[model samples]
Every structure is written in structure tokens, then in C-alpha cells.
Target: MAFSSPELNFHKNIGFLAFLPLKTKTSISLISGKVVALEILYRMVYNSLTAFGGQHHERIRYEQSLADAKKAGLRKGLYLGISQAFVNISLYGAVALIFWYGPYLARIECWNYDAGVVMIIFTSCLFATNSISMFIPYIVAFIDAAVAGAKVFAVIDRKSPIDYTNHTNNQPHVVRGDIELRNVTFNYPARKEKKPVNYLLFSFYIIHLESL
Candidate 1:
């Protein structure tokens, strides 16, 4: 199957996440959406500053994030699928029992104890089988998350990019505030796009992007 088929509706599970139709206490329709977007922006900035929590590159980290999100969604879908599968299997198994055992039980000489025993066994099996199935995904997910979290932590634990400068040898030469960076070019990842070389002129820096 082509897993990457047509796009899926984002609101299937999270449909009720927004009550656009229902009368909202707030005036704005996108109030909740806007808040969420802003939160994400701040979180990204925080991650960039404090930790390597975010993927780093010329926006390649963004693709890593998208991959993680996609993988997570796939795993969640798989877990739910597993749960549903177990439920259906249990139902079908019980029906088969009904067809094969129910009639036979009815004809039993002393049916009370035998019928009770059968039900208990079936119920026990139902819960046990489904419980194991459910637990498997959680255990796997936990392990996967732990590994991912470790990698993320490792990134954050890295040495600081800039160390403190010793001003001893560095006599503060009066800067004319004239900054000149020659032959500066930023080659952004993957794409053919070229980024403008960053320049900061203290007093007045005349920047002519010959690159553009």
C-alpha cells in the first residue's frame, strides 16, 4: 500500500479539540489556534537557547521534527489499530464459542457449574489476551521514546557554543564601527536557495549583497 496517499483529515481524532461551531466564550474563532501557534514558537526559541532539544541545521532540524511527528502519529495509529483488532478478535471468538459451546451447554445434565466455569475461562482469556496486546505497544513506545529522549538530552548536554572571552590581551581598540565581511555567502541546506549573508554594521555599515 502506498502509505503516503492522499492527505488525511487532521481533525479526525482531534475533531473536538476545537469547538468552532459551538458558542465559544471568547470572541475569536482562531483564538485557541493562535495561542497554540504562539506557544510552539516560544517553545522552539526556548529549545534553541537552553538545550539542543530542537534539531539543528539550516532548517533540516525542522524535517527531523516533522519525521518525529509523523512517526508518533503512525505509532499512535498502530496502537489504536491493535486495540481495535483485539476487541474484534475477542468478539468473534466469543461468537464462535456461542455457536459451538452454547448449544452444547444447554444440553448438559448439570449446567450451572459448567456454564459458570466456561464463562469465567472465556472472560479471563479475553482480558488476558487483550491486556498483553495492549501492554506490548506501550512497552515498545516507552522504549522508543526513551531512546529518542536520550538523543535529545545528549544534544542539549553538549558544550556551550561560545566561551567567555579574556579581555586582558584584547585592549578595547576604539572601533570606527565600520564592519566589513568579505565574500560572505550562506548556502542553505538541500535546496538551491541561497541565504543572505548576515551583516551588522556598528556605526554605519554599507552592505551590498553582491550575492543577490
Candidate 2:
């Protein structure tokens, strides 16, 4: 679909020009009615290559921003690994303690050996099975999902400048006539603080021919 705004058209042109070779841009500049187009294209290329260096520079900056974040992630992973190791060691240690103490209590304290053994084993098994720390990954995933869902809801609840649903006040109707946009002042939203681009009246016109 064609854009009605000059800013949108300008951006679209820039994107299209980025993929073209230098030879193509030079050839297009030689064509008539392409002065404005070539000027915009040259500015886009200069800004992208020298000022920004396109995605290459942006990618490096993006990676640089994530350097600390990546280190933090590695640290978190290491901590979790250490925690898991401790949990495993504790589980094995509990089992060993049960085996070692059960016989001692039975022989010295005159306790029933089988009953002592059963109690230790059952208690250890219960504690190991019911521990919630084992589900750390699932809990982290749930928290992440909840945070993302809140962000999505915030965006969904926000009011937009153009509402497609409120069509009752401005109902669509057909007009049998030529439609024209004349003397329109246009400004790119990103560059709103800058001066608006003004075009003279009738400098640009759209001819809509109706059926006879």
C-alpha cells in the first residue's frame, strides 16, 4: 500500500536504497524527476555509513550493552549449579547418616533395629520428595511469564490516537468527485521538533476519475 505521508515515503525510499549498489544509485541520480529522490538517498547512505555505519555499529553497541548482562547470567548459572550440587550432597549425606546412626541407636539404646531403619529411610525419603527448591527452573519460568504478561496487558490497555472501532461518528461514505491533498505541511514524527516541510498549494494533486 502507498503511504500518504512524505515521512513514511522517505523512510521507505531509504530502506529500498540501502540494498542497492553504488552503481545503481549513480544511475538513478542521472534520471530526471529524481533529484529529490537522489538527494534523500545520498543523505540516508551517508548517515548510515559514516554517522551510524548501519547495523554493524549498532550491533557492536548492542553487544557491548549486553556484556555485563551476559556476565550476570553466567554468574547466576554458576550459583544455581553450586546450589544443585549442595542439594545432591545433602541428600546423599542424609542417607549415609541414616545408615550409620540406625545401627548405633539399635545396639546402644536398645531400639528395634528394623523400626529405626524404617523411620530413618521414610523421613529422608519424605524430605527429599517434598522439597520445593528442586523446582527452581519452573518457578523462574513462571515468574518470567507473569512479568511478560503484565507488559502485554499494559500495551493492550493503552489508548491509540487512531481508533478503528469508533466508526459511528465518522461513518465511511462514497463521494463521486476528485479527491486532492494540497498545500499540506508534513513533519516526520521522529523529527517533530524540526521545521515542517511545506509544499505550495496544488503542487501535489491526486486525480480520482469517476465512471461516466
Candidate 3:
């Protein structure tokens, strides 16, 4: 099957990418089921390299990862603390300003509003300010969601270098021929000291039949 154009194929691919997360989740569950066996093999490898202390490299990497995790945690905590502090300050400052100005307005008769009206406005402002603080706890979650969304969209938006749907060139639909290799020999460069493997000759002929 072939698409009408590259853009149509691209759209079809974008539709396919929508199911990528589900595919990834299934793959992750399958991998998780094999984690125990994989861990056993990993431990065996680590044990085999104990004589040369190759395992120490892994230990160092683990320690470094732990340290990075701690640093990230600390940074997140700092951001949360600063944001909460700012929110609290803003909330209290608004309350203080309203209380101080409400009485001053009444005393000076600057506005025609009474005590009841003042209280209503004050309560509304208080509720609105408090609502902002409620979102502080979810700041980190929002950041993580934004980052994940960027990664997903990045993969979807990326362009492939080769357009396989383009068949303008003289490409054969069905190839029929004999494949022959004559005196082909090769060996790994690392094993140059050893004897080279030789392939003296080989041939594979195609057998085509006409429709009866």
C-alpha cells in the first residue's frame, strides 16, 4: 500500500504516534516482569568482574546518581519554599492593606461604601488570594507535565531524512536474478594474527515460472 503524498503519510504517522504512549506502557510492563531475571544476570556479571574491581565503577555511578537525585530534590524543595513564602507574603500584605484602607476610607468619607460593603469586598479578595496559594503544591507536578509533553511533541514533530514513499527513481518492483560471490574472503582486524576465513565461491540462481 502507498500513500497519496508525503504530507498524507506524515499525517498518518502523527495519528500512529498518538498510540505511542500506550505501546510504551505495555512494553514497560513486559520489561518489569523480566526485571528479576535481569537483576540475577546483572549480579552474576558484577561478581565475575570482582577480581578486577569492575563492580566499583558501577558503585561509583550509583553513588553519583544518588547525589544527583538529592540535589534535584533539594532544588525542588527550595523552589517550593520560595514560592510558598512569596504567596503567603502577598496574601497577608493584601489583607493588611485592605484592613488599613477600609477604615481610613470610612473615616475620611472618601467613598460612599459602608462597613458591610467593605467586608464583602474584603472577603472576596481574601478568597481569590488564597486560591493562588492552593496551586503552590502542584507547581512541581505542572513542571513535570510540561516537560513530558515537550518530549512527546518533539518526537511527533521530528522529520525523517529519507522519504521511503517516494518511488520516482528506476526502482524495480520485483527483482529476479542469480546472486554469486566469487573468492570473497575477510577476517576481523583484531584477530589478524589468526588465519583468515576464506569463501571460495557461492551462487544462488532464481527460478521463475510463467502463468499457466
Candidate 4:
């Protein structure tokens, strides 16, 4: 079957998307979206460092392709550093606020010191427990397996023009004899009207051998 250039390119890109740094991004997104809300921000900070290597590679490749490659690299690095700094500041700042305000509130309201401490500890533990749900290693593995299986099945399910495996009477059987080539026309599937040099030469040689 004939395929347009865009269709072929889309298929090629879709095939490679599964092999890209998707799992890492998914994990990081899960952690940041869920765990950050629970105040268990340290895990995300650690995970971010691990994920940065993949981003670094992507940034290097992308920046190097630009007209002002060095400037692009510098801009990317500065933006990343600033963003990471903000994240760190926000995480620690929230913790500091909790500790500082918790004591003040406890003293002013005549609440027990131990209760305030327990509240902070309990909140942290609650988020820590919830964060465990984000470690979906099995889910990622299953998704990868499913994608690979789909690709494999697509090829297997496709009907080839020439079925060598068919053993029925309707199928032609190969005999242990020399095959003859005559005035036959050959064209590639994509370009039916154009006779490529290699195909023309191959066809010519086959026809010449048959004549001899």
C-alpha cells in the first residue's frame, strides 16, 4: 500500500516515542503533582536530580542545533538553575513557615507543644504514605510491553502480497529448478512509474541469464 510522507514520518515518530525519556517524565510529574501537595517535597527534589541527566542530554542536542548554539546553551542552563532554585526555596520555605507559625499559634492559643509537634509530624507522614502510590514501576513496564506487543501484532496481522507459508493448492510451490525471466516490468511499491537504476539492472541481468 502507498503511504504519504507525513503518514510515514508520523508512524516512525510514534514508534520511537515509547523509547524516549517518557517514563522518567511521567514519574517526575506524578511525584510533583501528588507528593508536593502532601509536603513530602524532599523525595521530589531527589527524583528531580535523577531526571535532570535526561533533560541535560535533550538540552545539549537542541541547543547545539541553534544558530547561536553557545548562547542557547547558556540561556537554558540559567533558566533551569533558576527554576530549580525556586523549587528548593519554596519547599524549605513552607517547612520553615510551618515550624515557625505552629509554635506561635500553640503559645497564643495555649495549646500543648507536643500536639503542635505531632501535627507537623503526622502531616509529613500522611504525605509520605501517599507518595508510595506514585512509584508505579509496574504500570510503566506494562505500558511499554503493551506498546511493543501492539507493534509486533500489527506486523503479524498484516497480509503480505506473497504468502510463502501458504501450502494450499491455490499457492504456487517452489520447484528445485532454474527460474526464467522474460520481458517483465518491475516497479517499486512507492513509485510505480519510476524504474530505479538498481531494479532495472537487476531485471536486465535476470533476463540476460535466462536467454543464455
Taken over the whole model, the C-alpha lDDT of each candidate is: 0.45, 0.49, 0.57, 0.45
lDDT of 4 by residue, 94-139 (tens): 4565666666767876656556574866477445433432332233
lDDT of 2: 0.49
Pairs that clash in candidate 4? none
In model 1, what lDDT does residue 8 have?
A: 15
Consecutive 10-residue window with the lowest summed lDDT within model 4:
1-10
Winning model by TM-score: 3
Flag the better candidate by lDDT, 3 or 4.
Answer: 3
- Which one wins by lDDT: 1 or 2? 2
lDDT of 3 by residue, 1-212 (tens): 01112323343344234333433343333344344334445775766656665666655544543454455455545555665565666678778878888878877884786787779878987887676556555644545555458658998999886666878746667777767779888864323444465865776777844332
Model 2 stretches with alpha carbons more than 4 Å out: 1-56, 119-133, 150-212
Residue pairs whose backbone atoms clash in candidate 2: none
- Residue-level lDDT of model 1, residues 117-193, one tens digit each, is 66675566555544443443344344445544754799889977454475455454675545555555664333224
Model 3 lDDT-worst window of ten: 1-10
TM for every model, in the order presented, reads: 0.31, 0.41, 0.55, 0.29
Q: State residue 73's C-alpha deviation in candidate 2, in Å.
A: 1.4
Q: Considering summed lDDT, which 10 consecutive residues are worst modelled in model 2?
A: 1-10
